[model samples]
Target: MFKYVIQLILGFLTLLMSTAISWYEGSGIIDNPLEWKYSTPFSQIFNIEISSGQDISQLDYFVYAAKFQPFFPTIMTVSVLYICTVLIFFIFQLNRQLAIILSGIISCVFIVMSAIFFNSSTVGGNIFFWITAVGALIFISMGISLWYRKKYMFKFQPQ
Candidate 1:
């Protein structure tokens, strides 16, 4: 339990730091005309024309950073995923079966996310694709190892 708390705190701190850095990097688009084109994913997707920096939503700043400069945004994404994974593991630690099921579900979700970015032409898309693909592999491996350890490593003795 103590370890879980520590992990959660560390994850949260990482998330906060990454978010701040990403936000700062993203906000640079407001001053750089060259970045305006790279920051238009939100506008393109939502069909909203952003003629000026003032028209960009706060959330779009994150998207801008993610699209042009993926490093900090990637860290932010990984941090959030880590926090969620830790919480899920802590919640279902006592129930191996449930944990395994949840792990599989999470892995599938990651797989889908990876696929979504698989064909993206942007640097962020490539980074996200790899991140999600690796995440799927990690979750699936965790689920498999847990199942194997529970089924093969433990012998039940009748009382």
Candidate 2:
């Protein structure tokens, strides 16, 4: 239980940190007034042109920003996966096998998502960095859970 709590806390911290980094970097969402220009393929395809002194903080901006790079999407996906895994562990009471299987699925998905950006011009290498870290964390947590399963079998107690 303590180990699971630590895993959850770590996941939450990573999610928060990644989100903060993305926001700080703007992921090309927030445009500067002095350097407002749109000459990329995304701009041409989406017909997006940011004018100087224009505030752009719409859902479209968020979506387009993600499309611009895999970093944001990868981090967000890992965050959601981490949350879901925690819920499955606590609420569903799934065994270690299921958790490990889910981790494998997540790894496959992460690989595909990261691969999609390999040929993209706008994709940042930071996505690869985060993906590696998230993958390691997921596997490590799963391994720890498996190792301690016999010692700490999680049971739902109605209180």
Candidate number of the best lDDT: 1
lDDT of each: 0.84, 0.57
After superposing candidate 2 on the true structure, give the runs of residues whose Cα lies further than 4 Å from its correct spot. Answer: 32-94, 122-159
Per-residue lDDT of candidate 1, residues 1-159 (tens digit): 999999999999999999999999888677766766666667667776777777666677887788789999999979977986897678666787888888898899999989978988898989999999999998899889878876876576655
Tally clashes: model 2.
0
Candidate 1 similarity to native, TM-score = 0.80
Best by TM-score: 1
**Residue 11, candidate 1: how far off, in angstroms?**
0.4
Candidate 1 weakest ten by summed lDDT: 150-159
Q: Which residue pairs come into collision in candidate 1?
A: none
For each candidate in turn, give its C-alpha RMSD to the true structure in angstroms. 2.6, 7.9
Give all TM-scores, in the order shown: 0.80, 0.46
